[model samples]
Target: MHEQDFEVDYLIMGAGACGMAFADSLVTNSKSTLAIVDRQHRPGGHWNSAYPFVRLHQPSAFYGVNSRALGSTLATRQG
Candidate 1:
């Protein structure tokens, strides 16, 4: 196998909601480089494997990274 090297200030183990959120916060608050690693083909952790019909148990606003909203504000407002 070919050898590779990476240099980063932070190495996150997962690319799930929490991990992504943490990365977002770190990026917004600091100038550190980050490397996010995940086993799945995409991010979102378990959500990626969940059924398409599955829904969030709480408001969408409460489910994603701090810098962005998950869904329409009207949906959260109605709940």
Candidate 2:
């Protein structure tokens, strides 16, 4: 089989953040068909195995995609 064999608007290689976001945008803006495939069992890419110290280095509000807000919240230090 070749590229022409399968019919799809977008062939997403990985179901990572970028791929997922692209698919989401396509779904909301156009009627394109997407084929998302990932080596991992689920999405989130490296995040699935990210280091324990890895997190929103800044704030949650600035960590999410533009399409969806992370829900801005007032950060409070816990003793």
- All candidates' lDDT scores? 0.80, 0.73
- Model 2 lDDT, full chain set: 0.73
Let me know the TM-score candidate 1 reaches against the reference structure: 0.70
Q: How many angstroms is residue 26 displaced in model 1 relative to the true structure, after the best TM-score fit?
A: 0.6
Q: Against the hidden reference, what TM-scores do the models get?
A: 0.70, 0.63
Q: Candidate 2, residues 1-79: lDDT per residue as tens digits?
A: 5565577988999987788888888887888998999998987777777843564466666645645656456443432
lDDT (C-alpha) at residue 64 in model 1:
59
Q: Count the backbone clashes (under 3 Å) in each candidate.
A: 0, 0
Q: Which regions of candidate 2 fall more than 4 Å away from where they truly are?
A: 1-6, 52-58, 73-79
